[model samples]
Target: MRESAAAWGLQLARALGALWTSPNTLVGLLAGVAGMAAGARPHWNRRDCALVFHRWPWGPGGAITLGMVILHTGDTLDVSCTTYEHRAGRCEHPRVRLGDHERAHVFQYMVLGPLFLPVYLLCGGVSVRNPFERAADRYAMHGRGWWPGRS
Candidate 1:
């Protein structure tokens, strides 16, 4: 019982740390709640990252709506049909995939907080020239071995 209590305490601490360090988690949770209200369900990846999968009401041609949350949150990725059916599972390489790309964006959120979106937009968003995208791409290519600051 004592060990269980200690474990629970540790888990609570980690959750608090994630919440404190990453403000995006709050936004993600809010979005996840919205998704839940719309009949979407949350899925957890191997990294324990949480994402919500929903059929977009806006139709097939709608913009990608996933991953709007800031960073360090449980519900980091928001998946629409496009992200779910097309991007993530199609990769032949285990490490390189859309999830990794999105996770990299999560890391960017961790560092940038609320400014990530604005800076990402100014840097061309997901374009090839965007540093954030490039960093994410590199992370997808190299797993945790890659990060933004390294050459």
Candidate 2:
């Protein structure tokens, strides 16, 4: 009973977070829909709790996360990307650790909601000088906490 109650509380918190972040998520949905219409195949990454759109058109290459959506330039971005099904799609990401970095951004969107993009831009967008990106990189590289702070 205690476990169930805790689970319920967690679910409630997650729902609230989703609501808070819905605006950003809606923007992602629009972009994802555009990408889908441009030939990208959409796949659900349950582990990452995101809508992963593979083969997104435009932009050099690499993945970008908007709220709960991930627009990637390659094929699969799942942890199970080694499976035959994913390999058949030609997973071309130079970095296999991308999901964690992007997932960190997703979490940031949950916390910051509408302010995430502004903060990210102010922090230098996608550069190494960005604390958010640093934190996300740490999480991806060392599997540590992704919250922005020292180390």
Instruction: Count clashing pairs, candidate 2.
Output: 0
The TM-score obtained by model 1 is 0.55
- lDDT (10s digit) by residue, model 1, range 70-105: 222222333312222124454343334555667666
Clashes by residue pair, model 2 = none
The per-prediction tally of clashing pairs is 2, 0
Q: Estimate each model's TM-score.
A: 0.55, 0.81
Index of the highest-TM-score prediction: 2
lDDT of each residue in 1-151, candidate 2, tens digit only: 9999999998897687778888888888888889888898888887777888889996887788888888898887644222112234533333337787788788888889888999999998876667897687666656676788945
